[model samples]
Target: MGFCVESARVMLIIFNFIFWLSGVALLGVGIWFLADKNIVSYLEVVNHNVPNAYINYAAYILIAFGALIFLIGFLGCCGAIRRSKCLIGFYLFFLVIIFAGELAAGIIVAIYRTEIEHSVDKELSNSIKMEYTFANESAITKSWDTVQVELKCCGGKGPDDYMNSKFTNMSGIIIPISCCVLSDTNNMVAKDKSQCMNKVPEYYHEEGCKKKLIEWVKSHSVILIGVGCGLAGLQIIGFIFGICLCRSFKYEEK
Candidate 1:
């Protein structure tokens, strides 16, 4: 049995509403994440923590979600235009696929939360220790300053003067440094201009920062897992409802 014109029209409208809402939401989320403060510093400070992984994963997920939303919306629009329940059903099928993907990813994240937490903690603890140690050492501070000054003065000739140089020695090349590490003066100057050097060599050499980082990751794992599971469940409900709505339409036709 086919849908009565009025019922089909109403269903089509509802589908459009869902499509629009989902599409706009996805797009907004993607944009927000791209501009989010945490993501901006992702390359700088993200260690092995769940939060860091979440942030990175979330950014890409938002982008993927946005694209999926656009595709679903377009398919929904086409289904409406054709007045074909099969097409609409196909759309719902894809929705189910998306829901399944969410469920799987959420489960994986939850299952491995412990390992991720431990790794993150270690890296973070080490970073903190390096930072604190460097701060306490007066000699290291002076050397770093001298290096900075020299890097600035060398007419940008040294490695520090290179295009991606984060730290430069006096009249030498610039070196690249990681956000977690501080710039060092141990090497008088870098010979290679192309290589980007990490600034916090001492942080890598220490282990204290890693412990604190693990502590933080363990504390926050629950929230991330909860949200992931919640979103998956919600999507499944929506998918089931779509199927029921289809069935209802058929009954009305008979």
Candidate 2:
């Protein structure tokens, strides 16, 4: 039993409505993530088929979490209207689950991020050496070419990274043409493929994909933490309202 049923009921409804909207925002963001040009392409590369595993999991997590939060918010609103203690209980249960999940995900990411990056680096280098066939043009080859051209980066490191790859090492080339400065990137027209391949300073990008990708990941971490904190604050609000409404319903009955 608790105090102020009437006020609690009204406030609970208002808060749940806001909660519902947050879910929608999450859903929208998740969909937007999937629609991002290069990000979507990166998401498709999972397990052994592709690298960038961190982002691959995040995409699914966002969509699924968004849907879950949407349902909880809807249930919270309904519970407040009917004064259903069971529904309120269910709402609190799920909110706790979500909180725990977010915490766990954060901890896991913090511990494993560097390890994951190293693993991906190894796999990417392996792909560049063996899987990215220059003659046959495997998926990895095209993907690497696209990454190099679009990101304006060279190999996993710099152009010299290709020195160990079969195609470049055997062919005695320093870098792929994709590394070259391009007048028309869409057409894959390098301004100086020969010079780029020969490691000319003017003809190619010096930065490595590994460094570029790490920076990209770091940039998104702040956004993720912001979103997580926002959701966490909302869930705390929900917990308060849920308890107030549940106990107040009992008090009114008594």
Candidate 3:
């Protein structure tokens, strides 16, 4: 029985070490996602024009949860190494709370999936109509230009979506340079940027930003879902290990 308890303690310590490492990795990824200048640059467009706060909320939640997980994992590791029942018990309690909170969040998202999708589309369209401009001076303007250049897409719905835009009347330019596409040979030349000025269908991407964005999201949805499930599974395994460690400590005390 003593040997078994000792073995469990060793295993628990190993488990906690792995959990702590994972938490650190998660925290790093969250920070990278939030703080990367390029990513944040694109987010300026969303932040300025979109009314939807969910994206920012989600990012903040990820950072907070990752930090919590890191702290909890550290505590669990120490508790396991010392065979301290109080610390292990506290770890178990916190683990359960985190698990429940995640489960609740999943449920809420599932319930509102349709509404969320519609809201995102509506907000994106509104933002495009109200905020997008040809001038690339502001963060939001630069972000939209970046999106158009990177994605090779025009307005939210299409080039026609910009017909009534303030940019058209203000600049007397029908389309922005970012919307123009050059041939492979001329693509690198600076002067090619002005070549698409009056050239409509011949030089511009036909696909709308909204459709392209939605397609991009759809393509990655599976990966995101898999990652979420994997995290939940990890939490469940942590809970199990924590409980077993706490029980082993109790057995040893007796």
Candidate 4:
């Protein structure tokens, strides 16, 4: 039992580090996205659009993951410090809980990405049809329903329309700007004609879009600090406790 506990401590430390590093990297990426003006530029490099909503949501989740690691690490450290079998068992159980949370989060994100991908496909189709008739006035101003023809079309209006919808729903504070749309220039299929000429100026200066982007940044920041700081603190405390637990083991043997 002594050797087994010792070995578990060592393994736990290794796994804890792995979790911490991953959490940090994700947090950093989220911060960069929030600070940068042209998020699309960074996202383009990664072959993603980095939707405002996803960024906000993912940042919070990453923080939570980090906190879990920290808590488990701290608990393991405490168990080692006191050489308490009860604490050690508890630590292990908490680690399992963290693992389950990670798995669930992964599944949630996967489903979200799949849905978003489908939406993108639908958006691409609409963009293509719109592109073929670009110069035509009738073709230029597509209706809200016309935009919704794409699959997985959610509660939002258009792509930009979705932006407004997100703004309205974000944190229960609605900042309404009726005429907005998300550009499809980033679409994989109709990449060239993704930018609707009419929507370019609006993209840069639209109040609704700007407000939504700002809100995205704010909400994501809360998520990052809440999760990241909490996790880091937990890990440090856990490590200290683990050392004490380890010493206790030798004391008990003597």
Using lDDT as the measure, which candidate wins?
2
Q: Any idea what lDDT model 3 has?
A: 0.64
Give the per-residue lDDT digits (tens) of candidate 1, residues 1-254: 34455565566556556655665665565466467543333222333223445544644564576568667757765765665678778878887776665555555545555555445434433333232122224332232233233323211122222333222222233332222233444443343222323433333222222333334334444544454455455555556555655676677667
Candidates 2 and 3 compared by lDDT, better number: 2
For candidate 4, the per-residue lDDT at 239 reads 46
lDDT of 4 by residue, 1-254 (tens): 66655665665566556656655665565566555544532222112333434544554566566555566656665665555767776875675565555445445444544455444444433432232122223331232223222211222223343333333344232211113243442331222222322445433223222223233334544544455445445544544445545555656577
Q: How far is candidate 2 from the true structure (C-alpha RMSD, Å)?
A: 3.1
Every model's TM-score: 0.50, 0.84, 0.83, 0.40
Candidate 1 residue-wise lDDT at 9: 54
lDDT of 2 by residue, 138-251 (tens): 666677777788778877766666777887756666677788889898888989887776667888898878776666555655555556668789899889988988878877
Task: Flag the better candidate by TM-score, 3 or 4.
Answer: 3
Task: Count the clashes in each prediction.
Answer: 27, 0, 0, 17
Candidate with better lDDT, 2 vs 4 = 2
Shift of residue 194 alpha carbon in model 3, Å: 5.4
| Clashing residue pairs in candidate 3 (N, C-alpha, C atoms within 3 angstroms) | none
lDDT of 1 at 212: 34
Is candidate 2 or 3 superior in TM-score?
2
Cα lDDT of model 3 by residue, 7-86, tens digit: 77777677767767766765665576568765564455444544554434444555667678878888887887788888
